[model samples]
Target: MITTHPFNDDKLREECGVFGVAGAIDAAAMVALGLHALQHRGQEAAGISSFDGTTFHDHKALGLVAGNFDSEEIMRLLKGEWAIGHVRYATTGETALRNVQPLYAELASGGFAIAHNGNISNAVKLRHDLVRSGSIFQSTSDTETIIHLVATSRYRTLLDKFIDALKQVEGAYSLICLTEMGMIACRDPLGIRPLVMGRIGPEDGGTVIFASETVALDIVGAEFVRSVEPGELVVVSGGEIRSHRPFQQKASRPCIFEHVYFSRPDSIVDGSSVYTVRKAIGGQLAIESPVDVDLVIPVPDSGTPAAIGYAQQSGLPFELGIIRSHYVGRTFIQPGDGVRHLGVKLKHNANRPLVTGKKLVLIDDSIVRGTTSLKIVQMMRDAGAAEVHMRIASPPTMHSCFYGVNTPERSKLLAAQKSIEEMRQFIQADSLAFVSINGLYRALGEASREEEAPRYCDACFTGDYPTPLTDLSEREQPNQLMLLAERVGG
Candidate 1:
């Protein structure tokens, strides 16, 4: 079985991505391209569901989109003009075929298939209640909770039922669902997750597309439309589009980390270029914590843009001191602990000639558990670097994220457990610094994080969650939730 390389596993992971297209011929193929563009968000599994008026067809598998959806035979079977797809990393469910999404269900109204891109924080509690009321679940995915909620709602129309289901749950979600009526796209009220809309040319059947990121729309050659507004439900049917705001209006709190690491640098979120925001973040870091070093070096791909910003701001030459191997397959296997420990070079290696005598400033997006940072610093020292100072582009991640990010428990987060100096010691670096919380807000165009109603969700850094964590709150102890989650999954 393919697994994430150890060198790449010590980071917070976005749970999944969703893509949907309506009114296009050969729509499944377009969905495939969109999902492929979104592959970076989630890499464990992928699935697609399509509707061709009278019938619904789907194919789900435990692998990358290219591996599972590139076959002509599979595409031929997913016959429909309305399609939605998902790539998953298993935030709430087991890594099994049944847990793969674009989860399909045959409801009383018709066939319903949904692709979800965030966690339903109250899923376990809702699931327990649903089971006691005789709702038999087919998979452990929290997404299915929405389906069951819709199925049991007494609302008159499918749209009403869908809205009814959403109102009953809490936490971040950006969803794309396909049904007999047409296609529906919506984001939770807080907008902690992202969803955007786009339109294909008339030549391409004038398709309306929705995806977790603008990058996916770009992949399908779809023109950029506005984002699906928070607390708004958009429906495309009868060759016309309709928008609904079924819930009370509230200020949006989109995820701030999207600019730091989760999103592709090429994508745009909340009308700002992610690449530009990251560069600004790096500049903020340079201003807040100036360092005396010979060269500024980025950890690798994710850190490159920020490093450039830091270089421009601090007037230091940015160098690629660490070269990442592009050909290193995600499925690369290490047979044992000894082999795994030696596998760091399989992904990145220091440029010995460039770093032999230089005092370097290393820039990275964030330090999670600090294992990757520690190893990278050690590797640089082994290459004869005179000094290494680490600068983080974002505020220290001191809290766990429950809004669909796959973060370790708070206890395991390096920043949560250690002070900046302590983290420097743990990573064996000469120095370390992170952008202050207010500095992060400044980078994002806000003067400061408004404590009463912050503009974005920075919960992972501040522990200021916007929604009630029903499942976690119900647990009497920290570990009790893990036990309860296992039981709820059953």
Candidate 2:
């Protein structure tokens, strides 16, 4: 049997999603629901670890949540009052059961399990150090690095050891941990990733919830509380929640792409509505680049919201020019060679009647490799469209993201090597325009981005990484290595 990934192949991929709850009667089930709500963030694998006051129970598998955890038998096995779960789309490690998280360990402090979202840039260096110091690693995941750090720390409390573990790492992380002590939720110093807190039940006695997005909270009937502050470590135990900032504070720079593509439309991230922000980005694109088109069409699901805003702002009719098939599986057995060439058409079909003889505007979140864009433009022409113009909601993605997102190398990025005109030619579109960097910031409610110190991580677009790329710096071209080495250390 053969398996194939879903149709759209030109989009950036998110790393993972995490959810944790403390004090819930059915903690594992609640975590399941939260993970389901965040399924879009990661589709490769799912796992949950629960602490039942006396012992830890866990189930991890390599597939969707519905297939793995929906059974009553599976839920029954994960009995506990506190739990943490993770849905993974691997960025730093291979897709295997061992790499699947809520990675658990037995430390001097008792059972510790953690589910993480985002990449640890210094993991390679740290792993090398730990291995050299006689620490044995159970999994290949960088998340396990923290576990080792905690196990070896001389600190008196588990919280202190966890804090010490975090202080030694660099890169983006929004983590939810389960321990005999309690539930610990924390974000990195720069807040490059996102973690939100919520509550359910009566005010006096409620279940504390932590998840990667507000949508997760909504799914579980939890009231959305404030985000876990940058550089803040939150410990929930004994019906009480406490916050601490162990690392030096700095300006928070959450990943801006969450607004562009990663998060669910209904999610509220970093205090902004993702749907509204995406719509605004489309509106901004329309303002900056207007073309005479008969209709505005989205590339389906991801582009729907932005396309609506573009249609509204441009005074053009909105149409479903392309219809997406929801039934396509992650892996399918191809019967013959002839059917393999119809890959894009298998997932998306042009609405011939609506697209015939129309000069259409196609709006998409971002262009990664340009292969999907090329195929879609050809599909529109095949459906008798007079012309197809492309409008991108976010600025061109020029640099690879080392902070969790899976992106092609800089040399492979479409925009990194080609000019705007070249990109239009490559995608075979009549015309193409991307939202300006400043316009994107404006849509996000900022006047303009501060070149000196950006409010968010736009490194993929501007090449201005907020944190040091430790792993990449050591392996980059020799000419550039010297400069980066000096900036980051020897």
Candidate 3:
């Protein structure tokens, strides 16, 4: 089957899930198969690239990997013992075959393939420098910026080139790369993104796995190894793994949102159950923001379990407040924010009787811009509800996220501009309570990385961005791949 299944909006993003394998036959094919297991993180496009010691072969297309790839295609491109794969959501470039990755780059000695998760903070700066140096480009992706640096760097080895490129780029990234000599996986300095390592067994013919989430490893029968630490690099070749830690920055804080929203429930993100963390948030919301409610209403899909937890904590009945339509493709047009900020009507509608005339505490993952929140509240008000108290399972987003999550400029975020009281008045809600910062950590079962779960980077909530983002307020919107490349690839 070309397409394995479907996903939702919260599930769709510029962030992608990556998978790579070393020391195996048909490694490229295996990586492709593993990516299939992670299609939930991204579905707009898929690609796999392999390095067989002499050359790199890649095949990419704009569709679910299952529908876009077949056994015959895998075999035709399979040539290496090291392979890397990507499933993408366009954050930088337009959705097309050219933008699908793992993107390929040629070199004098050999080539490498790369699949990446996260955004480039200093892409504008880097792309400008590269362009001035006469480094021609292909594909309008932030990732190609890394290649331009690698191609021109005077480093003696590809590994060294990778390190140099890492130094030049700043932002959230978890990278899996395949070269003729080895399989390399690394995460950004702050660990703003996640990349874990796993193994099948040395004695069972020795194999290693690298993926954006541990769930993909578990699906393929691999034992969980430690996560590739922020600013650390690992190279696997010939059934052996070697580690590198050349760059160490400030505190290594992986994105907390991964546990709260981005990751799969089954995957252990830095060793925490994504499901457990969210449920705890729900329970806390109930205690901190309880309402004299007839029922606890969840926003649907992502909020279901939290709603259940809220109901349990508040002694209220839990009900599905909004039903999501599955199979809505990414191609669906999200109504523009200005003309119809209340885009929720297109994606959701209220079941009036369940909530009408009832004192209801409505729960949702978050309120990014508050436009949707305004609409949702209006919907509840229109449904004959006596009161609508909005409780977000996560903290207010006051900062723009450089790691992804489609956050707009800082000013566009309602939380950034308004006080808590102002937000309630603007949204026309009776009340609003967000999960406390410390409480949020506890909900994720806050534990040390060595103990179990790790600390997380909540830059968007705290304004302590893991890395600095270049100011782009003056830059015009980029179209096609060139715009993204020029803006972020430099």
Candidate 4:
């Protein structure tokens, strides 16, 4: 039977990707291309919603963008000059098609569709109150909570209604919405998630594109204008665009792991090139934990930049000791349980000749559950490596991410449960060291993580969450909120 690859479960999974284009000819086509570029952020499902003057069209499917949105039939069905798309990994909802987004609704105002990235920590509590007040929900996605809020809001204007909905929610969100008026895009006040605005032509008649990352804009030949400011909303209509800041501005705390793992290497987040920052992180890791090794080797694609930085800083040769198979798309048919046990090698395998008896420094982004790390160390030893010292580019991930990342519970986190030496023993590495939190801050060009107000969100490493976790606090009230969460896929 075909099953999704389980080897990638050891790392944090990004929640979703949002892409939209306004005032563009064949906007749906541009949105499809942009969604393809942001596919790494989400892979389980893809959807597109478009508005053509008087009518709105939508198409959603369970699979990759290439599998769903690449078809001429699907593209032709989504006919419009304004479009928004979403790729989802389902952090707050089930994997069923009913939960797939750019979720659309017919309201008193008109047809409204939304594509959302990030999570709402207070969704469960809000959902309970909404349900009690006669809000019938069709999907379990937290994004649907916003729609219900808009529908029941006392605000007069659609724009005011959107801002009203956002004010009631607590947590990270970057949203792209399609309304009869035009397209609206915004990031949460904390900027815990990412969104950027770009344009394809001259200011007057150009297509305005919004995406979760700059790489999405690049794919559609759009010139990046700027990141959507935290607490700011941008609206496009009739070939015109405007910005509004509805919430009070606070220090932005964009997710730091975006540079380490979530974003594509070519993308830029919060004015920093993801690839450049990753390399700097590797340099920091090397300085913090220098090792006597024959060569520096990256775990695979995600680790390559850091590995290069490590080699450059430590004055060692960088080698591709492990090769990853690009053919392993998302899922493969596994014959039986026994073969499943060896699935790790299907995606990655060591280059036997290069590391045959040589001591190596293995570079990786971070160790999550430690299962992948254990398998990789074992793979190196089996390939005749004399020694394997593992170096992590980021600090130990000791806390679960409650914003947008799909993380295991705190108990499952390797670093949260074990010390550095214990993790070294568990992974069977000769030595294991992670970049210090201060080192990570330095790599990002900060003096250090300020106790008063950090420039970036390092909650995964420091256990200092920027926002309140409402759902967790309501965990004891199973009959009221927690029970509702199970039914709503929170």
lDDT of 3 at 429: 92
Question: lDDT at 284 for candidate 1?
Answer: 95
Model 3, span 88-187: residue lDDT tens: 8777777667778888787885778888998887876888889998988787788888888889889988999889888888888899888877888998
Tell me the deviation in Å of residue 214 in model 1: 0.9
Return the TM-score for each candidate structure: 0.95, 0.96, 0.85, 0.96
| Weakest 10 consecutive residues of candidate 2 by summed lDDT | 474-483
Candidate 4 clashing pairs, residues 3+ apart or interchain:
none
Residue ranges of candidate 4 with Cα displaced over 4 Å:
335-337, 473-490
Best by TM-score: 2
- State the lDDT of candidate 2 residue by residue for 277-383, as single tens digits: 99999999999999999999999889999999899998999999999999877777767787865788878899999999999999999998999999999999999
Instruction: Give the worst 10-residue stretch by lDDT in candidate 4.
Output: 474-483
lDDT of 3: 0.77
Q: In model 3, which runs have C-alpha deviations exceeding 4 angstroms?
A: 1-14, 52-55, 70-81, 333-353, 381-384, 445-455, 471-490
lDDT of each: 0.90, 0.91, 0.77, 0.91
> Compared with the true structure, what per-residue lDDT tens digits does model 1 show for residues 1-490?
6566476666889999999999889899999999999999988899999999989999999878988998999999999899999999878888889899998888777788999999999999999999999999999999999999999999978888999999999998999999999999999998989999999886334789999999998888999989999999999988878999999898999999999999999999999999999999999999999999999999899999999999999999999999999877678766778778778887889999999999999999999999999999999999999999999999899878889998888778888779999999999999999999999999889999898889999989987778877877422236445534655694
Stretches > 4 Å off in candidate 2:
334-338, 473-490
